[model samples]
Target chain A: MRRARDPFFWGLFSGGGMLTALLLPALFLVTAITAPMGWFGMTGYEEWATLAGHPLTRAGLLLVAFLAFFHAAHRFRYTLYDGLQLYHLDALISIVTYGVAAVLTVLAAALLILVV
Target chain B: MKSQARIPTGRISDPGYPRASNPEYTRHHPRWYRRRMPIFWWLRKLAYTKFILRELTSQPVMYVTLFLLGKMWVLSRGPEAYETFIQWLSHPALLAFHALVLAGLLFHTVTWLNLTPKALVLRVAGRKIPGWAIVGAHYGAWLGLSGAIFWILAGR
Candidate 1:
Protein backbone atom coordinates (compact mmCIF):
# COMPACT_ATOMS: atom_id res chain seq x y z
CA MET A 1 0.00 0.00 0.00
CA ARG A 2 1.15 3.49 -0.74
CA ARG A 3 1.97 5.51 2.35
CA ALA A 4 1.02 9.13 2.95
CA ARG A 5 3.70 11.84 3.06
CA ASP A 6 2.59 12.80 6.55
CA PRO A 7 5.12 10.55 8.25
CA PHE A 8 7.96 12.63 6.82
CA PHE A 9 6.67 15.86 8.34
CA TRP A 10 5.85 14.01 11.56
CA GLY A 11 9.44 12.78 11.71
CA LEU A 12 10.78 16.28 11.26
CA PHE A 13 8.36 17.57 13.87
CA SER A 14 9.38 14.94 16.41
CA GLY A 15 13.11 15.40 15.80
CA GLY A 16 12.83 19.16 15.96
CA GLY A 17 10.64 19.04 19.05
CA MET A 18 13.12 16.80 20.84
CA LEU A 19 16.07 19.03 20.01
CA THR A 20 14.26 22.19 21.05
CA ALA A 21 13.04 20.62 24.28
CA LEU A 22 16.47 19.29 25.17
CA LEU A 23 18.63 22.25 24.16
CA LEU A 24 16.71 25.51 23.94
CA PRO A 25 15.99 26.11 27.61
CA ALA A 26 19.63 25.81 28.60
CA LEU A 27 20.53 28.22 25.82
CA PHE A 28 17.91 30.63 27.07
CA LEU A 29 19.28 30.37 30.60
CA VAL A 30 22.77 31.36 29.61
CA THR A 31 22.18 33.91 26.89
CA ALA A 32 18.95 35.52 28.03
CA ILE A 33 18.85 34.91 31.76
CA THR A 34 22.22 34.48 33.44
CA ALA A 35 24.33 36.50 31.05
CA PRO A 36 22.03 39.49 31.22
CA MET A 37 21.55 39.24 34.99
CA GLY A 38 25.34 39.33 35.63
CA TRP A 39 25.16 36.03 37.54
CA PHE A 40 28.62 35.32 36.11
CA GLY A 41 31.09 37.66 34.51
CA MET A 42 29.68 39.06 31.30
CA THR A 43 31.02 37.27 28.23
CA GLY A 44 33.08 39.57 26.06
CA TYR A 45 31.96 40.38 22.52
CA GLU A 46 35.08 38.72 21.11
CA GLU A 47 34.26 35.41 22.80
CA TRP A 48 30.74 35.31 21.37
CA ALA A 49 32.06 36.27 17.94
CA THR A 50 34.68 33.54 18.14
CA LEU A 51 32.11 30.91 19.08
CA ALA A 52 29.78 32.01 16.30
CA GLY A 53 32.71 32.10 13.92
CA HIS A 54 33.66 28.46 14.57
CA PRO A 55 32.42 26.30 11.71
CA LEU A 56 31.17 23.44 13.92
CA THR A 57 29.35 25.80 16.28
CA ARG A 58 27.84 27.63 13.36
CA ALA A 59 26.58 24.38 11.89
CA GLY A 60 25.10 23.26 15.20
CA LEU A 61 23.36 26.61 15.65
CA LEU A 62 21.92 26.36 12.16
CA LEU A 63 20.58 22.86 12.84
CA VAL A 64 18.99 24.03 16.06
CA ALA A 65 17.38 27.00 14.35
CA PHE A 66 16.06 24.93 11.46
CA LEU A 67 14.65 22.17 13.61
CA ALA A 68 12.98 24.64 15.93
CA PHE A 69 11.37 26.40 13.01
CA PHE A 70 9.99 23.17 11.54
CA HIS A 71 8.69 22.04 14.91
CA ALA A 72 6.94 25.35 15.44
CA ALA A 73 5.45 25.23 11.98
CA HIS A 74 3.97 21.79 12.55
CA ARG A 75 2.53 22.72 15.92
CA PHE A 76 1.14 26.04 14.73
CA ARG A 77 -0.42 24.39 11.72
CA TYR A 78 -2.31 21.92 13.91
CA THR A 79 -3.29 24.65 16.32
CA LEU A 80 -4.92 26.56 13.51
CA TYR A 81 -6.56 23.43 12.19
CA ASP A 82 -8.03 21.98 15.37
CA GLY A 83 -8.15 24.89 17.76
CA LEU A 84 -9.40 27.44 15.28
CA GLN A 85 -11.44 24.99 13.14
CA LEU A 86 -9.70 25.72 9.83
CA TYR A 87 -9.68 22.11 8.67
CA HIS A 88 -11.32 23.15 5.41
CA LEU A 89 -8.18 25.11 4.52
CA ASP A 90 -5.72 22.39 5.48
CA ALA A 91 -3.98 22.40 2.10
CA LEU A 92 -3.32 26.14 2.07
CA ILE A 93 -2.42 26.09 5.75
CA SER A 94 0.15 23.31 5.32
CA ILE A 95 1.74 25.10 2.38
CA VAL A 96 2.00 28.42 4.21
CA THR A 97 3.21 26.76 7.40
CA TYR A 98 5.96 24.58 5.96
CA GLY A 99 6.82 27.21 3.33
CA VAL A 100 7.60 29.78 6.01
CA ALA A 101 9.77 27.28 7.84
CA ALA A 102 11.66 26.44 4.65
CA VAL A 103 12.27 30.09 3.92
CA LEU A 104 13.54 30.77 7.43
CA THR A 105 15.77 27.71 7.30
CA VAL A 106 17.34 28.99 4.09
CA LEU A 107 17.80 32.45 5.58
CA ALA A 108 19.39 30.94 8.68
CA ALA A 109 21.79 28.89 6.57
CA ALA A 110 22.78 31.91 4.56
CA LEU A 111 23.36 34.02 7.65
CA LEU A 112 25.34 31.28 9.36
CA ILE A 113 27.57 30.86 6.34
CA LEU A 114 28.08 34.60 6.09
CA VAL A 115 29.19 34.81 9.73
CA VAL A 116 32.94 35.37 9.93
CA MET B 1 -48.34 -2.92 10.31
CA LYS B 2 -51.02 -0.59 11.67
CA SER B 3 -48.42 1.51 13.58
CA GLN B 4 -46.25 1.63 10.48
CA ALA B 5 -49.26 2.75 8.42
CA ARG B 6 -49.99 5.55 10.96
CA ILE B 7 -46.43 6.88 10.68
CA PRO B 8 -45.58 9.44 7.98
CA THR B 9 -44.24 7.86 4.78
CA GLY B 10 -43.61 10.44 2.14
CA ARG B 11 -41.87 13.32 3.88
CA ILE B 12 -40.19 14.21 7.18
CA SER B 13 -41.73 16.87 9.44
CA ASP B 14 -38.57 19.08 9.18
CA PRO B 15 -37.78 19.21 5.44
CA GLY B 16 -34.45 20.97 6.15
CA TYR B 17 -33.28 17.86 8.11
CA PRO B 18 -34.32 14.62 6.46
CA ARG B 19 -35.05 11.40 8.35
CA ALA B 20 -35.23 7.78 7.25
CA SER B 21 -38.11 7.05 4.86
CA ASN B 22 -38.87 3.81 6.68
CA PRO B 23 -40.87 4.57 9.80
CA GLU B 24 -39.85 1.34 11.57
CA TYR B 25 -36.20 2.06 10.99
CA THR B 26 -36.60 5.64 12.16
CA ARG B 27 -38.52 4.49 15.25
CA HIS B 28 -35.89 1.87 16.15
CA HIS B 29 -32.87 4.08 15.60
CA PRO B 30 -33.54 7.72 16.36
CA ARG B 31 -31.47 10.34 14.62
CA TRP B 32 -28.49 11.44 16.68
CA TYR B 33 -27.46 15.05 16.57
CA ARG B 34 -23.73 15.26 17.22
CA ARG B 35 -22.80 18.34 19.21
CA ARG B 36 -20.54 20.66 17.27
CA MET B 37 -17.07 20.99 18.73
CA PRO B 38 -16.82 24.34 20.40
CA ILE B 39 -14.09 26.81 19.33
CA PHE B 40 -13.08 27.13 23.00
CA TRP B 41 -13.02 23.41 23.67
CA TRP B 42 -9.52 23.62 25.09
CA LEU B 43 -10.78 25.91 27.84
CA ARG B 44 -13.30 23.28 28.93
CA LYS B 45 -10.76 20.79 30.18
CA LEU B 46 -7.59 21.29 32.24
CA ALA B 47 -5.64 18.69 30.29
CA TYR B 48 -6.74 20.22 27.00
CA THR B 49 -5.78 23.70 28.23
CA LYS B 50 -2.31 22.44 29.16
CA PHE B 51 -1.97 20.78 25.77
CA ILE B 52 -2.88 24.02 24.01
CA LEU B 53 -0.46 26.01 26.13
CA ARG B 54 2.32 23.55 25.33
CA GLU B 55 1.55 23.93 21.64
CA LEU B 56 1.47 27.73 22.01
CA THR B 57 4.97 27.61 23.49
CA SER B 58 6.21 26.77 19.98
CA GLN B 59 5.60 30.38 18.95
CA PRO B 60 8.15 31.76 21.39
CA VAL B 61 10.61 29.05 20.40
CA MET B 62 10.22 30.24 16.82
CA TYR B 63 10.65 33.86 17.87
CA VAL B 64 13.83 33.07 19.79
CA THR B 65 15.23 31.15 16.83
CA LEU B 66 14.67 34.18 14.61
CA PHE B 67 16.26 36.40 17.24
CA LEU B 68 19.33 34.14 17.34
CA LEU B 69 19.58 34.22 13.57
CA GLY B 70 19.36 38.00 13.61
CA LYS B 71 22.12 38.10 16.22
CA MET B 72 24.34 35.95 14.02
CA TRP B 73 23.68 38.24 11.07
CA VAL B 74 24.66 41.26 13.14
CA LEU B 75 27.75 39.50 14.49
CA SER B 76 28.91 38.83 10.93
CA ARG B 77 28.85 42.56 10.26
CA GLY B 78 31.44 43.27 13.05
CA PRO B 79 31.77 44.04 16.77
CA GLU B 80 30.07 47.44 16.35
CA ALA B 81 27.05 45.86 14.73
CA TYR B 82 26.82 43.12 17.35
CA GLU B 83 27.09 45.77 20.08
CA THR B 84 24.18 47.62 18.55
CA PHE B 85 22.15 44.42 18.61
CA ILE B 86 22.99 43.82 22.24
CA GLN B 87 21.99 47.35 23.09
CA TRP B 88 18.67 46.77 21.37
CA LEU B 89 18.09 43.74 23.59
CA SER B 90 18.19 46.02 26.63
CA HIS B 91 14.95 47.69 25.72
CA PRO B 92 12.22 47.11 28.29
CA ALA B 93 9.79 45.68 25.78
CA LEU B 94 12.36 43.30 24.37
CA LEU B 95 13.45 42.29 27.84
CA ALA B 96 9.85 41.51 28.76
CA PHE B 97 9.49 39.49 25.60
CA HIS B 98 12.57 37.47 26.46
CA ALA B 99 11.22 36.78 29.93
CA LEU B 100 7.95 35.52 28.45
CA VAL B 101 9.85 33.37 25.98
CA LEU B 102 11.99 31.98 28.79
CA ALA B 103 8.84 30.95 30.67
CA GLY B 104 7.47 29.32 27.56
CA LEU B 105 10.75 27.49 27.03
CA LEU B 106 10.61 26.13 30.55
CA PHE B 107 7.06 24.92 30.02
CA HIS B 108 8.03 23.35 26.71
CA THR B 109 10.94 21.48 28.28
CA VAL B 110 8.93 20.14 31.19
CA THR B 111 5.99 18.98 29.09
CA TRP B 112 8.20 17.58 26.37
CA LEU B 113 10.31 15.69 28.88
CA ASN B 114 7.21 14.29 30.53
CA LEU B 115 5.93 13.07 27.18
CA THR B 116 9.23 11.59 25.90
CA PRO B 117 8.81 8.24 27.57
CA LYS B 118 5.52 7.66 25.80
CA ALA B 119 7.25 7.82 22.43
CA LEU B 120 10.20 5.61 23.41
CA VAL B 121 9.55 1.97 24.20
CA LEU B 122 12.68 0.15 25.26
CA ARG B 123 13.11 -3.58 25.62
CA VAL B 124 16.10 -5.47 27.00
CA ALA B 125 16.33 -9.25 26.54
CA GLY B 126 12.56 -9.57 25.92
CA ARG B 127 11.83 -7.50 28.99
CA LYS B 128 10.33 -4.06 28.68
CA ILE B 129 12.09 -1.21 30.41
CA PRO B 130 9.97 0.63 32.95
CA GLY B 131 8.42 3.95 31.92
CA TRP B 132 10.30 5.82 34.64
CA ALA B 133 13.57 4.45 33.31
CA ILE B 134 12.79 5.86 29.90
CA VAL B 135 11.88 9.22 31.44
CA GLY B 136 15.05 9.14 33.52
CA ALA B 137 17.17 8.53 30.44
CA HIS B 138 15.68 11.61 28.76
CA TYR B 139 16.31 13.76 31.83
CA GLY B 140 19.86 12.44 32.03
CA ALA B 141 20.46 13.37 28.40
CA TRP B 142 18.99 16.81 28.98
CA LEU B 143 21.21 17.45 31.99
CA GLY B 144 24.30 16.19 30.15
CA LEU B 145 23.63 18.44 27.17
CA SER B 146 22.85 21.45 29.33
CA GLY B 147 26.00 20.93 31.35
CA ALA B 148 28.08 20.48 28.22
CA ILE B 149 26.82 23.73 26.73
CA PHE B 150 27.35 25.55 30.02
CA TRP B 151 30.92 24.32 30.28
CA ILE B 152 31.62 25.33 26.73
CA LEU B 153 30.33 28.86 27.30
CA ALA B 154 31.47 29.49 30.86
CA GLY B 155 34.30 27.08 31.73
CA ARG B 156 36.83 28.96 29.63
Candidate 2:
Protein backbone atom coordinates (compact mmCIF):
# COMPACT_ATOMS: atom_id res chain seq x y z
CA MET A 1 0.00 0.00 0.00
CA ARG A 2 1.24 3.44 -0.86
CA ARG A 3 1.36 5.89 2.02
CA ALA A 4 0.16 9.44 1.59
CA ARG A 5 2.45 12.26 2.77
CA ASP A 6 -0.43 14.50 3.91
CA PRO A 7 0.15 13.81 7.60
CA PHE A 8 3.37 15.83 7.56
CA PHE A 9 1.65 18.96 6.30
CA TRP A 10 -1.30 18.32 8.59
CA GLY A 11 1.02 18.05 11.59
CA LEU A 12 2.62 21.39 10.79
CA PHE A 13 -0.80 22.93 10.24
CA SER A 14 -2.07 21.66 13.59
CA GLY A 15 1.02 22.77 15.49
CA GLY A 16 0.87 26.17 13.83
CA GLY A 17 -2.83 26.44 14.61
CA MET A 18 -2.15 25.71 18.28
CA LEU A 19 0.59 28.32 18.55
CA THR A 20 -1.35 30.96 16.63
CA ALA A 21 -4.38 30.52 18.84
CA LEU A 22 -2.23 30.56 21.98
CA LEU A 23 -0.14 33.60 21.17
CA LEU A 24 -1.48 35.90 18.42
CA PRO A 25 -4.38 37.62 20.21
CA ALA A 26 -2.42 38.93 23.16
CA LEU A 27 0.48 39.86 20.91
CA PHE A 28 -1.91 41.85 18.76
CA LEU A 29 -3.64 43.43 21.73
CA VAL A 30 -0.42 44.84 23.11
CA THR A 31 1.40 45.64 19.89
CA ALA A 32 -1.43 46.71 17.61
CA ILE A 33 -4.50 47.73 19.59
CA THR A 34 -3.73 49.17 23.01
CA ALA A 35 -0.23 50.34 22.21
CA PRO A 36 -1.37 52.25 19.17
CA MET A 37 -4.31 53.71 21.04
CA GLY A 38 -1.95 54.71 23.86
CA TRP A 39 -3.86 52.79 26.52
CA PHE A 40 -0.64 51.47 28.00
CA GLY A 41 2.33 53.74 27.87
CA MET A 42 3.68 54.03 24.35
CA THR A 43 6.51 51.58 23.79
CA GLY A 44 9.53 53.48 22.62
CA TYR A 45 11.29 52.38 19.46
CA GLU A 46 14.51 51.82 21.40
CA GLU A 47 12.65 49.71 23.96
CA TRP A 48 11.11 47.58 21.18
CA ALA A 49 14.52 47.36 19.50
CA THR A 50 16.01 46.26 22.81
CA LEU A 51 13.43 43.54 23.16
CA ALA A 52 13.88 42.45 19.57
CA GLY A 53 17.59 42.31 20.12
CA HIS A 54 17.35 39.53 22.70
CA PRO A 55 18.25 36.09 21.35
CA LEU A 56 15.35 34.43 23.13
CA THR A 57 12.91 36.98 21.75
CA ARG A 58 14.26 36.50 18.22
CA ALA A 59 13.97 32.73 18.51
CA GLY A 60 10.41 32.98 19.83
CA LEU A 61 9.46 35.39 17.04
CA LEU A 62 10.93 33.08 14.43
CA LEU A 63 8.97 30.08 15.73
CA VAL A 64 5.73 32.04 15.84
CA ALA A 65 6.21 33.47 12.37
CA PHE A 66 7.31 30.19 10.79
CA LEU A 67 4.48 28.10 12.19
CA ALA A 68 1.90 30.75 11.53
CA PHE A 69 2.94 31.02 7.90
CA PHE A 70 2.72 27.26 7.39
CA HIS A 71 -0.65 27.24 9.12
CA ALA A 72 -1.93 29.92 6.77
CA ALA A 73 -0.58 28.08 3.75
CA HIS A 74 -2.21 24.79 4.67
CA ARG A 75 -5.54 26.37 5.58
CA PHE A 76 -5.60 28.52 2.47
CA ARG A 77 -4.77 25.58 0.23
CA TYR A 78 -7.77 23.64 1.55
CA THR A 79 -9.90 26.72 1.37
CA LEU A 80 -9.06 27.14 -2.30
CA TYR A 81 -9.56 23.47 -3.01
CA ASP A 82 -12.88 23.04 -1.17
CA GLY A 83 -14.31 26.53 -0.98
CA LEU A 84 -13.44 27.46 -4.54
CA GLN A 85 -13.89 23.95 -5.89
CA LEU A 86 -10.50 24.00 -7.50
CA TYR A 87 -9.60 20.35 -7.02
CA HIS A 88 -8.46 20.21 -10.62
CA LEU A 89 -5.81 22.71 -9.65
CA ASP A 90 -4.85 20.86 -6.49
CA ALA A 91 -1.22 20.21 -7.38
CA LEU A 92 -0.65 23.76 -8.51
CA ILE A 93 -2.35 25.14 -5.44
CA SER A 94 -0.27 23.02 -3.11
CA ILE A 95 2.91 24.04 -4.84
CA VAL A 96 2.11 27.75 -4.78
CA THR A 97 0.80 27.80 -1.21
CA TYR A 98 3.56 25.83 0.47
CA GLY A 99 6.16 27.30 -1.85
CA VAL A 100 5.26 30.85 -0.82
CA ALA A 101 5.25 29.77 2.81
CA ALA A 102 8.72 28.30 2.49
CA VAL A 103 10.03 31.48 0.93
CA LEU A 104 8.42 33.61 3.64
CA THR A 105 9.81 31.36 6.34
CA VAL A 106 13.31 31.89 4.98
CA LEU A 107 12.73 35.61 4.74
CA ALA A 108 11.47 35.69 8.31
CA ALA A 109 14.53 33.78 9.50
CA ALA A 110 16.83 36.20 7.74
CA LEU A 111 15.02 39.20 9.23
CA LEU A 112 15.06 37.72 12.72
CA ILE A 113 18.74 36.92 12.37
CA LEU A 114 19.53 40.47 11.31
CA VAL A 115 17.45 42.14 14.04
CA VAL A 116 19.90 43.91 16.33
CA MET B 1 -22.10 9.83 -21.27
CA LYS B 2 -22.03 6.36 -19.73
CA SER B 3 -20.50 3.20 -21.13
CA GLN B 4 -21.27 -0.35 -20.16
CA ALA B 5 -19.03 -3.41 -20.46
CA ARG B 6 -19.97 -7.06 -20.15
CA ILE B 7 -18.05 -9.67 -18.14
CA PRO B 8 -17.11 -12.96 -19.77
CA THR B 9 -17.95 -16.09 -17.84
CA GLY B 10 -15.43 -18.93 -17.54
CA ARG B 11 -16.37 -22.49 -18.41
CA ILE B 12 -17.37 -24.82 -15.50
CA SER B 13 -14.48 -27.12 -16.57
CA ASP B 14 -12.03 -24.41 -15.57
CA PRO B 15 -9.97 -25.47 -12.55
CA GLY B 16 -10.24 -23.54 -9.21
CA TYR B 17 -13.57 -21.99 -10.27
CA PRO B 18 -16.69 -22.45 -8.17
CA ARG B 19 -19.00 -24.76 -10.05
CA ALA B 20 -22.14 -23.60 -8.17
CA SER B 21 -21.63 -19.96 -9.21
CA ASN B 22 -23.88 -18.47 -11.87
CA PRO B 23 -22.40 -18.30 -15.40
CA GLU B 24 -22.54 -14.54 -15.30
CA TYR B 25 -24.24 -11.81 -13.31
CA THR B 26 -25.60 -8.81 -15.25
CA ARG B 27 -25.67 -5.65 -13.18
CA HIS B 28 -26.90 -2.23 -14.22
CA HIS B 29 -25.28 0.54 -12.22
CA PRO B 30 -26.03 4.16 -13.01
CA ARG B 31 -23.16 6.59 -13.27
CA TRP B 32 -22.69 8.62 -10.09
CA TYR B 33 -23.76 12.20 -10.28
CA ARG B 34 -22.05 14.59 -7.93
CA ARG B 35 -24.19 17.40 -6.64
CA ARG B 36 -22.87 20.75 -7.78
CA MET B 37 -21.50 22.67 -4.86
CA PRO B 38 -22.62 26.26 -4.97
CA ILE B 39 -19.81 28.82 -4.90
CA PHE B 40 -21.56 30.87 -2.22
CA TRP B 41 -22.76 27.91 -0.15
CA TRP B 42 -21.08 29.26 2.97
CA LEU B 43 -23.12 32.45 2.74
CA ARG B 44 -26.35 30.46 2.84
CA LYS B 45 -25.92 29.43 6.46
CA LEU B 46 -24.83 31.51 9.46
CA ALA B 47 -22.70 28.70 10.80
CA TYR B 48 -21.00 28.09 7.46
CA THR B 49 -20.42 31.79 6.96
CA LYS B 50 -18.82 32.02 10.38
CA PHE B 51 -16.65 29.02 9.68
CA ILE B 52 -15.51 30.42 6.35
CA LEU B 53 -14.80 33.77 7.96
CA ARG B 54 -12.73 32.07 10.60
CA GLU B 55 -10.70 30.39 7.87
CA LEU B 56 -10.42 33.68 6.07
CA THR B 57 -8.93 35.22 9.21
CA SER B 58 -5.67 33.39 8.46
CA GLN B 59 -5.04 35.77 5.57
CA PRO B 60 -4.80 38.75 7.87
CA VAL B 61 -2.67 36.74 10.23
CA MET B 62 -0.25 36.05 7.41
CA TYR B 63 -0.21 39.68 6.38
CA VAL B 64 0.50 40.82 9.92
CA THR B 65 3.36 38.38 10.16
CA LEU B 66 4.76 39.78 6.95
CA PHE B 67 4.40 43.27 8.34
CA LEU B 68 6.32 42.21 11.44
CA LEU B 69 9.04 40.76 9.24
CA GLY B 70 9.22 44.02 7.37
CA LYS B 71 9.53 45.84 10.69
CA MET B 72 12.42 43.63 11.66
CA TRP B 73 14.06 44.26 8.32
CA VAL B 74 13.76 47.99 8.88
CA LEU B 75 15.08 47.68 12.42
CA SER B 76 18.15 45.92 11.05
CA ARG B 77 18.79 48.86 8.73
CA GLY B 78 19.23 51.19 11.77
CA PRO B 79 17.18 53.74 13.76
CA GLU B 80 16.32 55.92 10.77
CA ALA B 81 14.88 53.00 8.83
CA TYR B 82 13.08 51.81 11.95
CA GLU B 83 11.61 55.28 12.53
CA THR B 84 10.31 55.36 8.95
CA PHE B 85 8.65 51.99 9.41
CA ILE B 86 7.00 53.14 12.64
CA GLN B 87 5.82 56.29 10.93
CA TRP B 88 4.41 54.18 8.13
CA LEU B 89 2.54 52.14 10.73
CA SER B 90 1.02 55.33 12.10
CA HIS B 91 -0.49 56.29 8.77
CA PRO B 92 -4.29 56.53 8.93
CA ALA B 93 -4.78 53.95 6.21
CA LEU B 94 -2.32 51.49 7.70
CA LEU B 95 -3.84 51.97 11.16
CA ALA B 96 -7.27 51.26 9.76
CA PHE B 97 -5.95 48.16 8.06
CA HIS B 98 -4.43 47.02 11.34
CA ALA B 99 -7.78 47.56 13.07
CA LEU B 100 -9.49 45.16 10.67
CA VAL B 101 -6.63 42.70 11.00
CA LEU B 102 -6.92 42.97 14.78
CA ALA B 103 -10.61 42.02 14.64
CA GLY B 104 -9.80 39.09 12.40
CA LEU B 105 -6.99 37.96 14.70
CA LEU B 106 -9.24 38.15 17.75
CA PHE B 107 -11.96 36.17 15.99
CA HIS B 108 -9.36 33.57 15.02
CA THR B 109 -8.13 33.40 18.62
CA VAL B 110 -11.58 32.99 20.19
CA THR B 111 -12.78 30.33 17.76
CA TRP B 112 -9.46 28.50 17.86
CA LEU B 113 -9.38 28.45 21.66
CA ASN B 114 -13.03 27.36 21.84
CA LEU B 115 -12.27 24.43 19.57
CA THR B 116 -9.11 23.34 21.46
CA PRO B 117 -10.88 21.05 23.91
CA LYS B 118 -12.46 19.07 21.09
CA ALA B 119 -9.07 18.51 19.48
CA LEU B 120 -7.16 17.63 22.67
CA VAL B 121 -8.63 14.88 24.78
CA LEU B 122 -6.88 14.80 28.13
CA ARG B 123 -7.23 11.90 30.55
CA VAL B 124 -6.04 12.28 34.11
CA ALA B 125 -5.28 8.92 35.73
CA GLY B 126 -8.24 6.73 34.78
CA ARG B 127 -10.74 9.55 34.17
CA LYS B 128 -11.19 11.90 31.26
CA ILE B 129 -11.04 15.58 32.08
CA PRO B 130 -14.25 17.54 31.47
CA GLY B 131 -14.41 19.64 28.33
CA TRP B 132 -14.79 22.85 30.29
CA ALA B 133 -11.74 21.95 32.30
CA ILE B 134 -9.72 21.56 29.14
CA VAL B 135 -11.04 24.87 27.84
CA GLY B 136 -10.30 26.58 31.13
CA ALA B 137 -6.76 25.24 31.09
CA HIS B 138 -6.21 26.75 27.62
CA TYR B 139 -7.64 30.11 28.64
CA GLY B 140 -5.56 30.02 31.81
CA ALA B 141 -2.41 29.44 29.80
CA TRP B 142 -3.40 32.27 27.46
CA LEU B 143 -3.90 34.63 30.36
CA GLY B 144 -0.65 33.59 32.01
CA LEU B 145 1.29 34.21 28.81
CA SER B 146 -0.39 37.54 28.22
CA GLY B 147 0.30 38.60 31.81
CA ALA B 148 3.92 37.65 31.45
CA ILE B 149 4.28 39.74 28.28
CA PHE B 150 2.62 42.69 30.00
CA TRP B 151 4.88 42.37 33.02
CA ILE B 152 7.94 42.21 30.84
CA LEU B 153 6.88 45.31 28.94
CA ALA B 154 5.51 47.39 31.82
CA GLY B 155 6.88 45.97 35.05
CA ARG B 156 10.28 47.46 34.34
Which candidate achieves the best DockQ against the true structure? Answer: 1
**Cα lDDT for residue B83, candidate 1:** 69
Give candidate 1's error at residue B87 in angstroms: 2.3
Query: What DockQ was computed for model 2?
Result: 0.53
- Per-model clash counts, in order, read 0, 0
Interface RMSD of each: 1.8, 2.1
Q: Distance (Å) between predicted and true CA of B134, model 2?
A: 0.4
Chain A: TM-score in each model: 0.91, 0.91
**Maximum-lDDT candidate:** 1
Candidate 2, residues B24-140, lDDT tens digits: the string is 433555667999988999899999899789888879789778766666666667778766666676788978888888888878878888988888998889899998998888889
lDDT of 2: 0.77
The pairs that clash in candidate 1 are none
lDDT (Cα, tens digit) per residue for candidate 1, span A27-116: 877776565444565466788777778899889989998889898999899888878888689999999999999999998888888644
Q: Candidates' DockQ values? A: 0.56, 0.53
